[model samples]
Target: MKGEKMMKQNQQDTPLYTGLTRFSQQHPISFHVPGHKNGAIFPELAKNTFRDILSIDMTELTGLDDLHAPTGIIAEAEQLAAAFFAADRTFFLVGGSTVGNLAMILAVCSAGERIIVQRNSHKSIINGLELCGAVPVFIAPEYDQTAGRYTQPSLDTLRQALRKYPDAKGIVLTYPDYFGKAYKMEQMIQLAHTYDIPVLVDEAHGVHFSLGNPFPPSAARLGADMVVQSAHKMAPAMTMTAYLHITGKLVAKDRVAHYLQMLQSSSPSYPLMASLDIARSFLATFSQQDKDKVMTSVKQVRACFGQGNAWQLLPATKLDDPLKLTLHIKQGYTGFQVARYFEQSGIYPELATNTQVLFIHGLQPFGELEQLDNAIKHVNDQLKFVEKHATIEVVNQFPQKLDTLAIPYQQMHLHDIVHVSLHQAVDKVAAEAITPYPPGIPLIMMGERVTVEHIKQIKHLIKQGATFQHPDIINSICIFADE
Candidate 1:
């Protein structure tokens, strides 16, 4: 609801969420990260411990070592992370995956070099493009009209791209997409390496994949050169706690270190760093046991949905993140309605958008669908809202246009772009990302010249109730870099 008003900006914004109050200097210690000055879950901590967080939120102390250029505790923390993920090196991110994503992109490719990338990647990747001025050979993902969503680009399409853009320095892929649709990593990675291009994976939603059954394998294990995961996404940890992994050919360990400095803050949060270290260590120690418990819970939830009473649960695979429970609301309850109903019951799903309600299962324990099944039935029995979902509409398979950044993409620069009203900005090169959210793929990056079809799609998104956010601006916008 916070960003409901900012949709016109063409950039995605955070939800209206309040910061949780933590233990103040006067409080005592207890939990992790904060080590908490002492231990007092402030009154607000009870609201959302994850939000209220802890005290002890400070820069690296003498024993802690620096995060930007670590040598002590931070280095040990990252080493432990690397061991857990089985990588040559692992950098802990107290910041979100965005910093790591940009760092990875900057580290892997020189400025002006082109990367064969998924157009559906997160907004962070757009920042990578802008910051490094890397020309992108965008691989658009598979669009689904049924749910107004998109899945990862097919292996077939990726191969086609690799074959065509032979000079692309490296490849960037997104594993276990926003909706939990995973790609065939084995195949994609194989294709990327055949050309000696390091595969950088934005596994922001993937940290929990290897730790659970219903989800897919880690892209790093499947052979990507670099992997970035938000440990906070599906794993039990504080927000902004993330991990960066390195593997395969051409990855200079020092370059990785350099970019971490380039993107990460000098004053890294000790508490957050400790949380990431604790989370990784925790994930290593309890991965199987925790995954087994999660698997059991998933089966129980599936049984509840199999009863076919109201809602239908989409059971994802080991190739997708298992904790992500994507469900289609049955009867008269919309996703939001069901989410709100759950919230009223003191439970909150991760997200509730137009047609799906996604609940993130984690290492934590909870009711194994017994309560959820009943609450859903109860909602169906009583709740009704104005948003009624009709039969799924299939997206038209339009002729694949011969669109590639190869032509204009190579020559464009970040400074040569400008933003304007979408209507007024017909022929100018884009200075902002014009991507469809939910699926998180860009039809046009910050410097790509828009085509008629691209413009049509943008207008369609505006007409059909999709919100667009311009990263730099806060109001209605159209973006094109200056000539």
Candidate 2:
């Protein structure tokens, strides 16, 4: 690896992110909890006298399957989930997929172990790296600079990465990216299994994919060793509701369970658990007519964008989620401006930066193309008032290739990180995670050496108006601890 560094990561052996579950049973003495009191958010429900807010909140008890030990209702619910996603085992998550991801990473990998990760993975992965001190092999996916968006890395790139680091712990891939672009997971899984390594998928925006078609294979079905999904992202489930699934012998269930207990909240949310079950039930009974309606609605929006010379939809090479739509903003209007336009119409997209604007359709009920049609109508009208802005930019389309390194999964002690400027960031040990959010991939990780070109690109992205993990105005980075 270029600029590879020999520094230790400062992350805990397991997870210390169970903040939510830690304060779960904090005796409600009142005068705290933001005073929402849960007493009057709804006059009728609050006054209905089912159970006091304090009484309703309880930890794992009789009839309640312990999240750490799913043998009761949680087990039953998870069984239904296995059927829903067609996985061998499924476990519910209370603190969102982020916690699910932390648990999965910690379970499959130890501190100082190497894992091939997308340069755009979620910040939590970086947190895992810091906690477990894993060495990250960063790979850039297909970045459509013109559109200001990124797609999945090509298979060639991933394979090369494997060849380069045959000892790597495994791989973590994001499905239906922030803007909705997805790689063919089956192929990635097939290649990964050949090496006897696990594949951890961050299916945050893809819970609904397992419900029906037009969407590609969910990670579990594609043979990933472990997969995490954010149910709230596309389900009627409560916020922070999600799940983790195990499908292969390479990943032991007890190992995943121990890590889940270590990283997740012990006093999980009961409502959230019930929501996951109900949402799956809702998804199970959905009609083909409804799926068609969802598809038709999105196609109309794509058609409208095609009408305007300012943008174009990237061609689909495989089965893509009909609800995940990314528009290559053209005519000098960046993803930022287009997102602003959607904002005016009260139509918020899933994500947008200088190059791409993504509109995610999760809930079929609230997802109506007519609303988007109205929004696009307003945008097209506004564009006419600007310059001869119809000229499209050069479309830089790259084939989806990947490179995998022979990185291994290991553990290291936590320490302070050494920081440097963007110019000198490369070749030095990375103390922090430099990443892009909408796609949730890291540009740099814990022990990897940064490069001058990497720094240059980071600066360019900032100048082009891209955002990173900005902890403060003076500091744009927070690195790993020094050895």
Worst 10 residues of 1 by lDDT: 11-20
In model 2, how large is the Cα lDDT of residue 117? 79
Assess each prediction's global lDDT (C-alpha) against the native: 0.66, 0.66
Please give the distance, in angstroms, between residue 440's alpha carbon in candidate 2 and its true position after superposition.
3.4
Write the residue-wise lDDT of candidate 1 on 1-483 in tens digits: 666434222112111010111223334333344443333434563635643344455434444467777776567667657755868888888678888899888887877787888776798886787677777777767875433456667788888888888888778888877767676778888887788888899999888665544557788888888999998886778889888899865687788889888777777765677677667756666646666776787667666556544467775654556556677766444566666677776667776654567776666556746677776666555464345544332243223422444234345543444446655666666655665554555656655565566665665444434445545232335453445
Candidate 2 per-residue lDDT over residues 318-371, each given as its tens digit: 566667667777656667667777789998877876556776665553446566
Error of 2 at 166 (Å): 3.4
- Model 1 scores a TM of 0.77
- What's the lDDT for candidate 1? 0.66
| CA deviation > 4 Å runs, candidate 1 | 1-55, 143-148, 212-214, 305-311, 329-346, 368-371, 382-402, 405-429, 434-444, 448-475, 481-483
